[model samples]
Target: MQAFDLVSKNISQIIPIPIYVGVFVVLLFQVFPRIFIARQRSIGQSTANRPGKDSDTPNGIYDRKPSLSSLVTPDPTFSWRDNPQQIPREIKPGKYFLTMNVRKLDFNDYIIFDKRYLSEYRERQAIISNVGSARIFVAEANDAALDLCEETLMVTVDFLVTRYPSMFHRTERGVLCVDAGEEYDLVTRPWVRHPLETMCLLSGDDCILMRCCNDGVLRVAAVGLVYSLDIDWTSFVGKDLASIHRDARIPFYESAIQKSVDRYFLKLQPDKPVARANWLTQIGPELRNEKFPDEYFRHVSTIPGNTITPETVVDDLYFRVERQAMRKLPSMRGVVFKFHLYATNIWDLELEEGVPRRFAEHIRGLPESVLRQKHCLEYVDCILKVMDLMAERQEKNTTNFHN
Candidate 1:
């Protein structure tokens, strides 16, 4: 034992304690970061492998991106017009108020291509030309707008080609192959400088990219408005959630649901997308006009209980429903708010079973304050009377057919 101790003492003396300390310091500086980085990599891999929780999902953008390889092929025969999405059954009789009513969104259902595609795209181009891209789309100056734009385009084209292989393809470099015509490449166009505009022109859809600010509230980091988009794009740019919702004047959003929604946006996971729907009964089929933004929306502010009677309301009623979906852009650290609006003249759908009666009942159930916020309280009676008439005619037709 003394011999072993003597040998160890000799070795220690030969190395010198200060030299040992120097070598240890070198290793700490050089090796620890790499080890720490490796540990981080391992954690990320494990997190991706397992399901993501709000608390655990890494904020790194590159962790998970939607790619063609990951896409779920849509039903070959799915027709957006014929196969209208089922109106979510979240509204309850006598219990109607503002609600998120969001559901898990399948990637395949992210963008809806309908009979209105060509017309909508034409309208989008006109809007772009008239309003200019700056009016509709905005993004953070320092963030990965380029990457987000490109990645978004890639996923979008992948989805379109996969969903409607006959209409769109990756054969050339475009999203379209509608005819024996030139196929659009699966890439951005050289002529368009603005990435978001290119996305709007190609996809012809409405989407806004939002990121949480330092204050912990989501704000409009980007926009790509081409359709009859929901948000008044110019109004909410750079505005936080509280201010945006307040400006939006959505009933109960500020008081009842702001915190919940703020947390929802803060914690939204990249892999999991959610969806919701909003319905409005308006006096006209024209829900929006891009050239005169928000003009149509505000015109219907007060119908005056006296101005809207059953006779006047029946001819002018239209129902507009916007199917909305929200998903996190992992790469951009943003949440995308997407909407597809479907408007049908109530005169056309009044006969559809349960359409008028259900909507009327839901509207009637709204508290007076809610109705006032909705701009319909003064005219609620007229609206209900028209609804009853439609419901009666529908029931009578059914009874006649049965008899």
Candidate 2:
């Protein structure tokens, strides 16, 4: 035994302790990480493709998939003619008040997944895939916007899973199941993937999630918008409400409007969701890339006396209405502003009995400054001509009735 110990001691002396320790340390660093990474990848693959009990079976605890046929039909109908009765009493045509105009949003109106869902979802997914994290913004947990995103995502998911069970399934494993048997990890942290991304995955609405700052100004911290109209959300990030509306043609930041908006945000309760509508006229129906430089519109004016008629207006212009909703998240105490866009041909306004007249009256009542600010000066004549045609048609109908 002494001889064996003397041989081992001689070998140890030949190879220094520090060299042995360095070799072990190098192997530890190299081998463990590879093993850990391999294990993680394997686990991820299994989780993604793991087969569970069929979601189609009738189960008391699990919800069945929602019927697509029934879900596509929009409720309360989106008619400009019917808008007056639907609008709050305080909101009138000439004077626009955000808070007073808003009404309690029905659960069905909260997140609309219409027939355009598939197309819109595809476009949104493409944008997110192409842009990566550019569309997602995050602030520190201590920041006012911290919990806004996650909470909004949670509520949206819960609402869909509960109400439209056929469309969304909650797995026994606590995973969210959507179409094509796909599963999502809804509980992932913002650093891994913002909750807004998950929301985009679930619906077509363009979400602009905001939170009140220390300075008492609402700042847009996160956005998941694929069809933003004339606005780049990136520029608005971290900006206060007033700053965001500084260049807006509409008088959204007027003293009264600003105060009401502030108060609305402050007093908004989790139980109540408020919705308001904004309408605009655009030259095309393209959903994405609605944003163009102001100079581009200005340059359109330089073209010498471009002739436009009622027929041209009907053929060329589109009417866009954005249904916007503001809901306060109970857990985060932050606001989630969602926008659902709809567009129709300008001539389609005539289909509704009173909508054309109301629209014409509203357009004629706008001040010159506001018209120029909205860049409507160039096409105002065309819109007026179309309005005249509608008026003439209404007058003819009245005359025939009297005869």
Candidate 3:
């Protein structure tokens, strides 16, 4: 005991008691945890570096490669043209005033690829080439806009490959369209085009992305229109819902459904998708990239649109219907709107029971401002006359068949 006390007194003299105490605390509190952490890290590295092996492979484990996932059979594509029931029946136009005709939709039917692909593609390419991509593909330049654009492209590409696997298959580097003989790298786009533009070129539907801004108003962030039917794409980018309504010159939007539209978008859930139908009458049957839309839309610059009459309208009119869908993004306060266009001549309207009569009655009831807004005023009277006659013939045929 005397010897131990003598050694302790010597140590205390060499180093102050406080210094020894501080060294003890430093070792106890800081060094131990660090030592323990380093031990754990070493163990983790060894485990991770260990090669993965199959239960059956005791010897060949070091040389084994990772097993690939099982191949999946693609679901049968819906042949919308062959299946009349699958094809949406022409919407019987109803009411005169503007209204949100949106209804819930199944994701499987969000965008359609049907018989019209080639013609639509041809027209889209031509429009982009002739009018400049600015008119067809316009977008805002910002982080929010770009993120949404990229997300939209990813979502659409995944859908296309899954929905039409035979036509679009996944490659190591990208998605390949067997029909087009073109491969698109989803991760990389052409230097001249935006990601959304590349996606628009590949998709059958035109895409428009809208984001809810700091003001809590939803505004268009990006847009790619195959053909600008009623509204121009350039004017819509970065504009709020109200601005878009005004720009489209939609009649009674503010008084009728502006607030409702805003509320609908704000409350829209990612799971719930909605679609609406829109119609317009073109001067000719799906007029190709017009040689002179720069000069005239009415075909002859001298004639003017109002000169069209029932007798003159028979061969000169085309009915266009747009299947527009809007849905919310799961990760962002934004929505993706898409348009799928379908067109038929006036004569085809008579094929469906009561469609001719219903369409004509619907037209006659439309308010003048709404008619002008839709660009239907030019051929409204002409359509009414032709459809009335067609309706009579349909009625007469039904009567005779029953007898």
Candidate 1, poorest ten consecutive residues by summed lDDT: 289-298
- Residue-level lDDT of model 1, residues 276-373, one tens digit each, is 87766556655353312123334443545445344565466556677788877655356778776666665666747877777778887888767765
lDDT of 2 at 335: 76
lDDT of 2 by residue, 108-184 (tens): 65765555655666676777777664544434345445456666766677676655566677775334545435666
lDDT of 3 by residue, 241-292 (tens): 8888887788899999999999998887555678887876665655332321
- The lDDT leader among the candidates is 3
What local lDDT does model 2 show for residue 267?
76
Model 3 ranges with Cα > 4 A deviation? 1-74, 77-95, 189-192, 229-232, 287-310
Candidate number that wins on lDDT, 1 or 2: 1
Please identify which of the two predictions, 2 or 3, would achieve the higher lDDT against the true structure. 3
* Candidate 2 residue pairs in clash (backbone atoms < 3 Å): 65-166, 66-166, 66-167
lDDT of 2: 0.62
Tell me the whole-model lDDT of each prediction, alpha carbons only. Answer: 0.65, 0.62, 0.69
Candidate 3: global Cα-lDDT?
0.69
Using lDDT as the yardstick, the better of models 1 and 3 is 3
Candidate 2's C-alpha runs over 4 A off are 1-100, 130-146, 172-182, 188-193, 229-232, 291-314, 394-403
- Shift of residue 39 alpha carbon in model 1, Å: 5.6
Of candidate 3, the 10-residue stretch with the lowest lDDT total is 63-72
